[model samples]
Target: MATGSVKIDVHHITRVEGHGNIVVDVKNGQLKQCDLEIPETPRFFEAMLRGRPYMESSHITSRICGICAIGHATASLRATEKALGVEPSAQTVLLRKLNFHGEMLDSHILHAYMLVAPDLLGAPSVVPLAKAAPDVVLRALRMKKLAGDLCAAICGRHTHPIAMTVGGFTHFPSKADLEALRQRLIEARADVDATVELFQKLKIPAFERDTEYIALSKPDEYCFIDGVIKSTDGGSWPVEQYRQVTNETCVKHSSAKRTRHQRESYMVGALARVNVNFDLLHPKAKSAAGALGLKPKCVNPYMNTVAQVIEIAHCVEDSIQLCDVLLSRGVTWEEPVAPARLSGEGVGACDVPRGTLFHNYVIQDGLVSGANCIIPTGQNLNNIEADMRALVPAILDRRPEEITLSLEMLVRAYDPCISCSTHMLDVKFV
Candidate 1:
């Protein structure tokens, strides 16, 4: 009889936001089990939101995730607009896309340089990268700042901007302000180019798992702002029908709800979006995707960082085009009508940097009666665990410390935002 035993566990993961754990058990020459746990702590975001004025939902929900504040805010606004029965003007849509792109860029850079790259480069943190390659670190900072500036210009603040509203922005950007942003984005094109090259050269782990990819899709052009929910397996449903496709259920072991579609776990985020809408990507984005060797469907989760960099370039290029359109036509703003009687249900979804985010609302009178928010992290949780399962057997022979590091690195590759996943709850590990 053969006998062996190994166990790897991470009690508290640092350097990445939120709280979570990875546990692996090996026995008798076969992997025993792998469990990913999210501790439950109740924040009561939905319960507290009950009876709040519809206009305030954006501000309130924006608190759900600090890392993706703009995403939450944008989702809230879209829901409120649906409840209020208003479609924002063209300029409003463009401006909102710009703000979202900035947030996406900020998030992608943070994940690429700060979270994921360190592991690939064998560094504990980006601090070492900052010392060894000051220029690289500085470029990341500059790119991040550009994203912040774009967010500030559109929403009045980078972290938790309050300028976004249901109908349209509370304020509009001046021509000079818009022009300055345009020029800055134009100048930063080279930086974006460099970033693409930098990510392409990084060595990523070889762990490939196939899962259904989901993202928003439109008939023409990349569907970043609005579109029906689409999947790589040729399954799609309207945005309003997302709940029918996505079923969230509670697991005894996890504080975060496990999401599955048709009884199978699925994947979302940059790779999913890139896979589902490769044809719809902006021309420059298409070029970058080609350069990165990303196909119509990308299965390796580790390559998500590369897809994110391609997306950054796409967003910057798209922003420049949007600015050109805005400058040529001049700035225009219009306030939409507020729905007086709001007894209805509506759904809204957008392509955040991580993945597809869905928001559903049940409104009564002029207040939000019930709200359900499905973030990308929740969708990717099961997939992350599955990847960990596949990775453990291969690394079981390695030292415990090495095994732990590999497991943690795999988690970071998903770029899981635990705060966003458990927005309505407080996390506590038992």
Candidate 2:
């Protein structure tokens, strides 16, 4: 163990996305402290959303994060729909789910094979992975492209697609387009299988801490689109009751609001989803989990990469099934009836690739009176800091560079969409 004091600071973490910092303090062989600071200026998305047309909420909120634009779009639409008491047709619902699956698969692959894998493999970036292991990288990119293709088929374009609207879609994909997508996803199953196997083979550092994992859980199905907010600690409430279960408090140390449950910090994201909905996963996902020796209750945060890969496979399978249904029954493009009266409040929550995303809205005179969005990255900020506090003590004796690398690796595992939480902007470390 080293004697004196060592302070390691990582400001403006690069490569992945968003703005944040990780600081570790050590003294006299004991870890003194750690802080995960979110200096990314808040855009006051909720504050800015006041008085916009209710119908435009989805479009406006989708700009929160470029990487997860579709996720934000879907969550915002779900909340707006709830507030207006409007439900889209069955076909619209299925299409929305397909869009979400594509976004998840796309984001997960980017994180697993591109952003996160380089750290584990001691490479600088995925570019090198492409050069060194061209075949592996190509396969991974193909799977990622499939995800993009899925999104394009349903939403019209892969990035920030504009087809989604409140009540129902402005247009629906043709039957032939849907069938082609289904066929492509079916062919990519082997790639997903390989990705899952690759994740299982990677050596994940053991950093386990008992945390309250929060996610969405429905009674009959694995929740991606809708469900009640649930936690591993046996605490749950309806989506509307989220403000009661989780409290957001601001600290002088960071720009991002810290979230706590029962006065103790909790975590939400892929790990939370998998732990809360292990049984709800598609049978193939469950089988993959089993093959990887993952239990229903996974505690190690690093294992989230595996969970994400499993989810990608599940999403592909689910999309295929949904396409099969659409082919048999067909779809209709119908706009929902504009609300006869539009003065009310509603809340919505969905499980994003990162975690549970909550949106609340107040609609008056057919316009958005007010809006509040609680993103997954903001929810996990406090928990990430807590984990750092616990981890620094274990690795304080190592070289400063090694310690810094380890800490950064831990943060990347979350695959945070920081830009979404705080409007899109460059993250600065200081």
Candidate 3:
């Protein structure tokens, strides 16, 4: 190992959701300080949910992230519905799953194409990649547009959805709209295959560290909207026990709180989900994973990008099936289910594009008396640091620029939404 005094100070990393700095120091062949410092201010989403009417939490908290807004809204609605003792109809469930698939396609494509692809392609950003690989960029844009339109057709818009409510949706997609979307999804398989091939050609760094993986787990299907919180560490918990699994605590360097469960840190996202639920993936997605050389129990953080691409295939294929199911059953208009009771406590969990997200609510007198939202990025922050601590030393022999790039790629592999992670604090300032 050829290491003297080395310091890497990235003022702010690019190609992520929000602000964060990577600060590393190594002295005389000895590692010293390494931290992924998050400086984004806390967003107080939980506090804002307090005292809001039960019907409003979904719409309000969806603003937590423009990218994962549908995920947030879905989780928020689940929590509200459970708290108020409202069970969604079967039709509602199918539509919500399709809507969730739209977001999964939108976000995974955005990250895999616009954010993480630049690093693998040796470009500064997607702007350069667009010029150099116009066809590739156009494919990404095409898929993204389809995903957004899918969301708009069902949920009224891609960003913060307007139609989804506590028990059901305000509007349903027309048969023509659903049929058109189904056709488009069927056509997108070639693009998804191209995406897999592109990543297969690009070399991901060879790095691996065994860490615990966690995500929402369902026995019958690959999970997203609802499942138990399952961990690779060999335990499962209901959504209500998420606090025990998360164990979020404040750290000195980051405004975002660090989380741990059964280990110093654990991972939650595409890699984790793929590891925890690989057998449950759709056959096409499994083929994509096979093509990308991604298999269960994958430990390399960089391969998270690869897993995301696999999920895109899954989303497209699954979306087509969902469209078929909906068409066969026929879309029927139904009134939103009213709350059977207004006083209860409930927790909701969803496997978003990022990872397992949890929302807990306490309802009293038809209003939200308390709320807690554990973001996927927040859950992954500590694991990122853990990965960094392991990775920095292994690559210390490389030049500073190379080291910095490796670290940047490591962070981007998580596809973190930092602003969403920094949502809530347990401190009171005088």
Candidate 4:
């Protein structure tokens, strides 16, 4: 048995969506190597779009990740439209933003209740939590179900949406449907407040690193649907100039590519969004952030989970407001925006639940000639490794079990969808 050194190989971390290995080796307290290895094979989502009709591109790419199906679909449609130079109507933009909020609520609820709750409560899984804290679990299930209904009302399905298209939705939700969803969200406000209270009492670990943060930002609001890519390092770039900032390079250990922006590693997702666009958050969400002691330039990665909590407040309230507007305007049956020409190229950047997602496409003669997607988890992989590099040595004196749990919790904090990041590294627009 090795006594003076620590050797840990946590193969396939639990609770996260896909396979990854966390390998750390320390010999006589001298750090040897620590790597968060992405061993899963790549899924070539972009290549699949080749030769497909531009209309079908959104449908095919929406299958990229079940949790981020709306994000993928939204980004894909935006790219398709930009290529064809057809601007969506004001109603279309409103409904699409609402559609994304539904996904944010649904996906965040799962991460908070189903995944992170077990770790926080010292339970093995949500199954045990159902017995240990049935009320808490029930609230989550109710909220999740309601959120799913919101998405389905707008997009025709939750997991893989069908109604949303490149130019606009096939049809808008009925007045009755919007009214019912508004009522459900009103009823769920108490549940969201309960969640805030829960997070307020839980003890999150203390760890901080001043990493560069990036997200999409636009005028007068938090731009989830459309924006320029802005970095906290005081650099902002157009969506088309994404490659200049991403600087994505293939790595030996990760099937997912590593990325850097203005520094060695930068973070994305809720924390980055909060850090960059704190002023634009809904008042309730801003209040939640204030209560949680999460201010701008917050360096602690663990607080990413807290940022997510704050966003739940925002998503619910914003969705309600969106619903009110849609109801007042009245739902209307509209056809998808027709393309001006078959040959064009465009790129889209949008804020998802996790972070900024990029989709670039070239439509040649009514078919998608090429495509590329940049995933949030892919951007965070290097940042997570950087955190581990700093963390392990500080906690080396602690028991092995404690160290292992801390690392796992750190990864869980990001709420990473690994399979979503398993996109191919080498992509060339045709």
**Cα-based RMSD of the predictions, in order?**
2.5, 2.0, 3.2, 4.1
lDDT of 2: 0.80
| Model 4 Cα lDDT, one tens digit per residue, 95-137 | 9999999998888899988988888888999999999999989
Off by over 4 Å in 3: 424-430
Worst 10 residues of 4 by lDDT: 421-430
Over the stretch 1-430, how does candidate 2's per-residue lDDT look in tens digits?
6776778878766655877777666777666667776677778878767888888888888878776788888888878888887867788878888888999999888998998877777679999978877877898889888889888888887677788888877768898898899899889988978887777778888888888889999988888877898888897798999897669888776777778986378878877888998988899998888877678578777778778878887888888998998888897767764664677888878788898888889998888888888988888878777877787777767888787777787788888766666531122121
Error of 2 at 299 (Å): 1.2
Question: Candidate 2: deviation at residue 13, Å?
Answer: 1.6
lDDT of 3 by residue, 1-430 (tens): 7668778888778889888888888888777888888888898989998898988899899999999999999999999888888999999999999999999999999999999999989889999999999999999999999999999999999999999998899999999999999999989989998999999999999999999999999999999988899999899998889999999999998999889999999999999999999999999999989999998899999999999999999989999999999999999999999999989998989999999999999999988899999999989988988998898889888998888889888999999998899842111100
Clashes per candidate (backbone, < 3 Å): 5, 4, 0, 1
RMSD of 1: 2.5
- Off-target runs (Cα >4 Å) in candidate 1 are 1-3, 423-430
Per-residue C-alpha lDDT of model 1 across residues 242-282, encoded as one tens digit per residue: 77767888876677888887537888888888888888778
Structural similarity to truth (TM-score) of each candidate: 0.95, 0.96, 0.98, 0.97
Q: At residue 350, what lDDT does model 1 achieve?
A: 84
* Model 1, C-alpha of 369: deviation from truth (Å): 1.1
Any idea what lDDT model 1 has? 0.80
Which pairs in model 4 have colliding backbones?
Answer: 269-354
lDDT of each: 0.80, 0.80, 0.91, 0.88
